[model samples]
Every structure is written in C-alpha cells, then in structure tokens.
Target: MFRPLELFIGLRYTRAKRRNHFISFISLVSMAGIALGVMALIVVISVMNGFDNELRTRILGMVSHATIAGVGESVRDWPEVIKKAEANPRVLGAAPYTEREAMLQGQRVAGALVRGILPEQEPKVSEVGKKMVAGELHDLVAGGFGIVLGKELAYKLGVDVGEKIVVYAPEIRATPVGAVPRLKSFTVVGIFEIGMEEFDSGLAIVHLADAQRLYQTDGPDGVRLKLDDMFKALGVARELAGDLGGLYRVRDWMQGHQNFFRAIAMEKRVMFMILSLIVAVAAFNLVSTLVMLVTDKQADIAILRTLGATPGSIMGVFMVQGVFVGVIGILIGVVSGVIMALNLEAVVKWIEHTFGVAFLSPDVYYISDLPSDMHWSDVGLIALLGFVFSLLATIYPAWRAARTEPAAALRYE
Candidate 1:
C-alpha cells in the first residue's frame, strides 16, 4: 500500500507539542472531563442497582409477596385458600392472615394495621418468626388471647411483653349490651424489629384463631402467599386468582411499592442523561484542541497537499489520534470505576469506622451503608458513545487541515 504524505504529517502534528500552551491545557481538560463522566456514570448506576437489590431482599423479607382474599370484605374459607396456594410450584410459603385498621388505646394512642397470623405457618412465610428481639416463636404458638407488637410501636404505647393493650374497632354485634364501638384487650407476648420505620410504627400481629373470633369471621380473612420470586408477584397473583375464580380476590406487593420503584427508575434515567452532558463537553473539547492544532500546522498541511495527499486520508489521521486519546482515557476510568464500585460498601464502612463518621444514616434513608452493583451493559454503552463522540469531534478540524491551500500557506515561508 502506498503511504500518503498528508497522513504522515497529520500523525506528526498530533505528537508534536503546539506553541499555544492553552490548546495543550484544553486537551488535558478534555481527557479529565471524559474520565470523570465515565466514572460518575458507573458509580451512580451501580448504587441505584444496589438500592433495588436491597429493597427486594430486606423489605420483601418482612412483607407477603401476594395475598388472596374474598372479593367482599373478607374470605370465609381462608384456610382452604392457603392450602390451594401452597400447591402452586412457585409458592414457597402460605399462611392465613387477617388485617384490620384499628386504634390502639394507651398512653400514646396510635393507629395501626393489626394482622393475625398462625404461629407455625409464620416461619414459612414472614421472617418475623426469626426476628424476635424480646421473645420466642413458641410464645406466639401457644394459643392464648395474646399478641405481639413491633418494637417501635411498643415503645410509643409504653407497653412491654406481658403488658396489656386495648385495640378498639367498630363492628356490628348482636349482644345483650348492644354493640356500638367494640374494644378488645390482649397481653403482649413478643416484640420484633425488621429495621424499617413503617413496619415498626404501624404493624401488630396476633394469633389466627383468636383474631378470627374477634372479627367474627368463619375463617381467615385472607391467605398471604410468599413466592419463590418476589418480582413475579403480580403475574403469579393474577394467575392464581384466575384459577380460583370468584371465590377470592388476589393482591400483590407490587401495588405497595409501585411508586417507590417508579421513582428510582425515573431518577436513574434523569441522572444518566445529566451526567452524559459531561462526556459531551469533553468530546467538544477534543474539537477545540484539534481545531487549534490545524491552525498551528497550516504550513505542514499545505506542504503535504503539494506532495499529493488526499483530503480523506487527512481526515482519517486526525480521527485516529483523537480516538487514541479517548480510548486510553476511557479504559483507565472504566477499570478504576469498576474496582471501586465492587468494593464501595467495605471501603465506606472502613472510612466510617476509622473516623467515627457515617456516610449515610439508616434513619435518614432506606439503608445505612453505601452499595454498588456493576452492570456490563452500561460499560459497553459508555465506551461506544465515547468513541462516536470522539470521531465526531475530529470532523471540523480534520476538514480544516485537508482544505489548507499550498500556495497561500507557503507564500510567507
């Protein structure tokens, strides 16, 4: 293959330091800009992914994935529903449940969702059975007019295990005293902590049989189903409900966290777009550097033109040099970012412990520690976008170099 003189000179111009120190400074800025953009994108995206994973694992551990209840008010045969749900392949655990919105009357009165559950089946479904802070599962198993309260709720109501609390609710009852507002008293058997404010402040648990008699229901109010995959809660719930027909109405946990997941997804997209602008600015910086180089190397370009070099080959040479700069910077940033992302949690923990300072507070946010999860698709996309922008940045300057007039440029020289 015949070598073009213009191509040789373009390569030489890229390597040679320009007289304009500002252009060299601009080139360095461009490299730094791209590196920062790539690194930020990877770190931010990974943290978002980590947050998502945490929600599925930590939050889902306490909540039922899906539930099946009667369409009108409550299901009469919740036990049968539990049996049917347990037969499903994807169902890991099934338990009868009853939930009622009631006011707990005590020193500090608070509204709460009182859920009734069977002690033996509780372990198969909710991790509450294992997260007992002040009591045992056996205490919940022995049938009695006893209940368990969340640690925070117990604190708010100034109650403890073995203490009595009254739950007030409105129910239609035919009694000698004629029912108006009904109240029930039960001894607290245990307290649990699941590391979430909502659960602690708003939830209470009791025995299934005792609660069924309190609510005057023939059976459980609903069947809480825990699935092998929480992500499939909606699909599995719909399919399971259709199988049961009009006997029950199905509900999934997706409804409870829809707004939450949506907000995270939206924020991820917006942040990615905003950060990409930094990469765009870096590519434009490449344009400025190459533009200045063309102006300085006018005489060299003219000499190459006079020696028979094509404009296309001149464009190729500048593109190659610009891509080289971009590729080197991107590779460095990607490697560094990935290593940091993989180890971010441990590093943040170490910093906090060493300095007695917390990077993030569980009280202020959903989590207490920094987290990251690498997604290779994001990496590939970043590299490809950087390459395209770099190639684009080469265009105007390379065209200017190719258009140099041999006669006019060499006239003074």
Candidate 2:
C-alpha cells in the first residue's frame, strides 16, 4: 500500500531540524509539559484513591455495616433476629450488642461510649479483636469486669490494661434517690488501635453482660451486622426493614459516617476537575507548537495542495502528528505513575527520612503514614483526555494549513 506523499512530508517535517532554535526549544517544552502534567495527575489521584480505600478498611472494618434494632428499647432474643437476618444471602455475620454513653473516671474524667460485646461473636462482626495492640481478647470474657479501651483514650486517661476504670451512667433507684447516673467500675483488659482518632479517643468495649448490666437493660440494644459488600449496607438495611414488617428499624454505615464519606467523595470529584486543567494547559502548548510548524512549512503546504491533496487529508496529517506527541507523553506518564503509586509508602518514608519530616502523624492525621492505590481506570481516563485535547489543539492549526493558497505560493517563488 502506497502512503500519501503529503503524509510522508508531514511526518518528515515533524522530524526535520528547524533553523529557528526557539521553535525547537518550544516544541521540546510542549512535550515536556504534557508529560509532567500527566505524571502529576496520575500520582496525586492514585494517592487520593488510596486514602479513600484505606478509610473504608480502617473505619468500616471496625464498625458494623448495618444494624438491626427494635423500634423503641433494647433488642431481646437477638439470636432470633440474627438468624432471620443471616437467612438472607447478603448477610455475612450478625452479633448482638449493648452500648451506652457514660463518663469514664480514673484520675481524669472523659466521655466514652462503652460497647457491650460477646467475645466469641464480636470478631465475626467487627475487626475489634484483630486490631488489639496490647492484652488478649479472651481475657475480657473471664467475668472480671474486663474492658478494652482505644489507644488514644488509654493515653489520654494515662491507663492501660488491668487498670481499674469507673463508668458512670444514670441509674434508676426507686427508694430515696430518684433516677440518677448509674456508676459501675470495670478493669481494663485490652487496648486496641484502629487508626481512627474519633474511635481511639472516645470508644471502649466490654462484655455484653457487663454492658447490659451497666445500662440496666435485660437484653442487647441491637444486632450489628457485617455484609459481604459493605457498600450495599443501605440497600440491604432498607430491604430488611421491609421484610421485618416495620417491626425492626435498620441503620447503615452511611448514617454513622455520612458527613465524612460525603466530604471525601465531593473532594475527589473537585480534585479531578481541578487537576484535569493541568492536562488542558499542557494541551494548549501543542496548539502553539502546531501553529508554529504550520507557519514555517507554508511552502510545503502549498506544494501538497498543488499535488491534489484534499483539505481533510491535510488535517489528518497534522492531527496524527499532534496525537503522536500526546501519545508519547501519556505513555511515559502512566508508566511512571504506576511505579510511584506501587511504592508510595517507601518513597514517602525515604523523603521524610532525608528531609527530617513526617507526612502523617497519628495525633494530627488519622493514619501514621502515606498510602497509595494505583487505579488503571484513572490511567485510561488520563490518556483518553490527553488524546482528546491533542485532537482539539490540532484544529485551528490544521484548518490554517488546509486553506493555504497553492497558486500564490508558486507565484511568490
């Protein structure tokens, strides 16, 4: 197959050494700009995606995806509710829980939500036991008024496992004193760190019996559920509520952390839009480069037109050239992004070590280190957008090249 002479010349012109040093430098700058923009977008977006994923695992893993509860009071015979909920294929595990808000006093008084959990079943529903940094899970079930505190809470109160902590909740005394804050003491049995400041600072866990007794309730407040896909929690909760004939109310994870997750999603979308402009600016460089090339090759354009080249073919040649520029830059960017994303933790560590700085601090940030999650879809999108921009950049220059006057060029020569 013979290729068009105009196309051959177009490619040749792209490769030819220009007499103007400024033109060559501008062309190189355009290519470099595209590469840097693409690479930065990929790396930043991947890190954002990584943080989103880490939040899901670190936060959702410790809490129930959904909860099945009665209309008013604590749930009695939660075993039956668990059985009914588990009957659905979506349910992974369910466990009864009793919880209350009270002040924990041990030289210092701080507000705390003491969750009552069954040692054997808690692990099935939450990552609480798995995240235990100190002490043992089984020790809490030994009926010694054992309790588990979060790392931050332990630090704040200056207490650890085996230390005694008093919990105060409103108690109902019918005799002389009316309803008053009930006071109960528990021995700290475990300390856990889930990398969540909110939980680590204000959450504690104890035996279900202890919690119910502490709350003066005969049964658990509700049943917490883990699902195969936690993101499906809201939909499943709605379905379960309907199945229960409205006798039971359902609450999902979205309700618990609505503001936080919503903010994150909104930020991601905004960042995508903002970062895409880097690609747009870089693409504009292509427009300038193509226009300059067209101006320098005016005689060649006239010759191609005299040789019977159609305007569409003229456009195709330059468009292909612009696309080539974008393709090379995008390929380099994507490869670099993947390499950096995969090793982001190490890279951050190395930078911090060299600069004597910290990227994330447990007290300041929820996590203690940098995280990165490379997404191929994001890479595909970046390359696609770059191609589109390149094509757009070729338009004005291509139109000018296609409209060159063949007769006028030969007359001037």
Candidate 3:
C-alpha cells in the first residue's frame, strides 16, 4: 500500500526538525535501551555456551562415552564384550573396568570409589593416562598391588607416591572369632588431577586384576566404550544393548550426568526470557514517540488528506519511520554484541590484571578463566525479536494518525 510518495514523506519526516525536542530525546533513549539489552543478551548467552562446552569436555575426557555391563556382579567374558563393541563402526575404542567403594587408611582415613582399569588399554577410552601428575598408569601392576590416587584423595589421606595405604573392601571374610571386612595394603603409585572435585576428591585407580582380587570378583564389572562422536553415545549404547541381548545393561554418558546439564539449559532459557523484557520495554517506547509525532504533524497530515492521499498511505508513512528506527537500533545492537562477545575473555583478563582482583580464583573454582563462545545464530535471533517488538509498537499510533479529520485538523492549524 506504500507508494514512493509515502516513502519520500516518511523519510523526510524522520530527518526533518521538529518543534517538540522531547520526542527526539525519547527516540534516542529507546534506541539506546534496545542496543544495551541486545548486547547483554548476546554476551551472557555466549558465556553460558562456553561454560557448557568447557564442562562437557573436561567431564567426558575422564569418563567413557558409553558402557556395557553384565547383568550380574561381573562380566566374565569382558574381552569378548570389548571385541563385539569394537566390531561396530561407530565404536572407536573399548576397555574393561571394575569399580567398588572402599575406605583407604594412611595417616588418615578417607572413602573413595576405587576403579580397576587395564593400564595398557586405559588410554584408548579415557584421558587419565595423560592427566597424571606424579606417576604413570603403568605403575599400577597386577601382582604388585599398586594404586593410583586422585590428587585431592591423596592429600586427604595424607599419602603420596611410594607410601602404603590400607584398603578395606565391603566384602566380609569369615574368621574364627568373627566376620571382618576384607582388607589389603596397596602402595600409592600415581596421582592424577582431573580438575573436577567429584573425581579428584573421591576416585582411586588400580589394575583390573588387583581390583578383582581385592573384591573377590571373577572378572571386570563392565566394558567402557569411546565412540567417534560423543553426541551419538545414546544410540550406540542402545545398539550395543540390543546386540548383547538381555544378558547385559548399557548406559551413555548423558544418563550419568543429566541433572547437571539440564539445570544449565533451564538457567539459559530463564536468562533469555528475562533479558528479552528489556528489549520489549524499549520497543514499546516507540508508541509514545509516534503518538507525539502524529499530533505534531496534524496540519501536514490534513494537507496530504485534502490532496487525496489514502488512509493506508498515511499509515504506511508512520510505519516506515517506525521500522527505520527499529532497524537502526537492532543493527547497532547486533554489531556491538558480536564484538563484545568475541573479546569478553580478553577484556575480563585485562580487568583482573589491572585491578588485581580475581573474578574466578583458581583456588576456589575449577574453571578460573572467563570463557566466551559466540554463536551467530543467537545474534540473529535477538535482532529479529527486537525488530518485531518495535514494529508492533507502531501500529496503534499509525492507525490514530490515519483516522485524523482534514477539516478539523486544518481548522486547528
């Protein structure tokens, strides 16, 4: 409905000087508000994405993508299970492991989940071999009864490499006097730091044979598998379960830590909703600005109506002006937001260095550095929403302007 005449007049009105300077001030404020809201949304979302990615990487580095375990206490044919798992093209690596909760006594006593792994094959499924700080995975020998401790667990037990610690298994041994917990002494052979407190504070590693011997199990508890793509863990696990039949159980990495990731996703959605309100308020400001502009231009509107301009054309004039303002604000916001998100990490580091203050101290937080990962899709979504809000704000005021009576408007003028 908008002709070149409406377009020319709308552009002229937007650029033309007005007697009411307050209208200009309100328009500027609206633009600034939209820009600020969009920028904040982009930066916050990017940081959240970065944290999600960082945590996922660290956690997955220590855990397998999927696992297949026996229906009973141990998988007697674990090597066969590994072989079958490796036969799948999606499965990249597999290793057998046994796990049990035990108490370690040294200078002090601490509880931990002790895991048994084949040192030769461990590197294929997990990164513990690469994360050791004090010793190597090879130090955990089957007959020697050597153990690897997490850095925090070692500190809690007041033990180090070469020190001996007593391990008490949950299984009981019958004695002449009474039944007692099965116990063994294992020399600390290695220390590893995964950076996550859950692992670093409560995990111990030993040879698969040693764990089986200590727990009195005939074989390893399960087989862990690493896939070519971590995201496909669930599908691969399901296929393995079907192939292995009802005799085994299969689980994916996501099943073990669903709550943590779900909470993060919920928080992100809430943040987006809260931030969108800011842009909505700014866009609504356009309503008041257009109403005032329509009143100010009544005489001009009357002249155009008397000259036979249609009401639809009159409405289009104001709509074009409002849309132009919205587009400008969104463009400014998108450009500024993208730039800030890309440099947020560097900016945070600079501030910390200059002020001698740590926002995330290494002593207190596992992830000490500020991280930002910008996604262009988020920027585009924000811009689109801002424009839609701005466009909706112009409707009522434009309709009011279109309904003006030429005779009354001219008489007033």
Candidate 2 lDDT tens digits, 46-149? 88888898998988867899998877887887888988899989998999998788889886878888888889988888888888999977777735789899
Model 1 spans with C-alpha error above 4 angstroms: 1-22, 172-179, 354-356, 362-366
Where model 3 places Cα greater than 4 Å from the true spot, the runs are: 1-4
Point out the higher-scoring one by TM-score: 1 or 3: 3
- Tens digits of per-residue lDDT, candidate 3, 195-252, equal 8998999999999999999999999999999999999999999999988986799999
The residue-level lDDT of candidate 1 at 204 comes to 86
- lDDT ranking of the models: 3, 2, 1
Find the number of clashing residue pairs for candidate 1.
0
In model 3, residue pairs whose N, Cα or C atoms come closer than 3 Å (at least 3 residues apart or on different chains), thus clashing, are none
Estimate TM-scores for all models.
Answer: 0.89, 0.95, 0.95
Which residue pairs in model 2 clash with each other?
Answer: 169-181, 169-182, 170-181, 170-182, 171-180, 171-182
> Candidate 1 lDDT, tens digit per residue, 1-413?
43664456555655787788888788788887788778877888889888877766666777789988777767776667777788889999898888887788666788888888888888787898777898865575535878788888999998989888898765765688776666788888899887677887788888877777677767777888889888899999988987897568888987988898898889988988888787788877899888887787778767767777677766776776677667766777688778878998988888898999877887676578877888999888877777787778888888887787889999998
Q: What is the C-alpha lDDT of each candidate?
A: 0.79, 0.83, 0.92
Model 2 segments beyond 4 Å from truth? Answer: 4-7, 171-179
Span of 10 residues, lowest total lDDT, candidate 2: 170-179
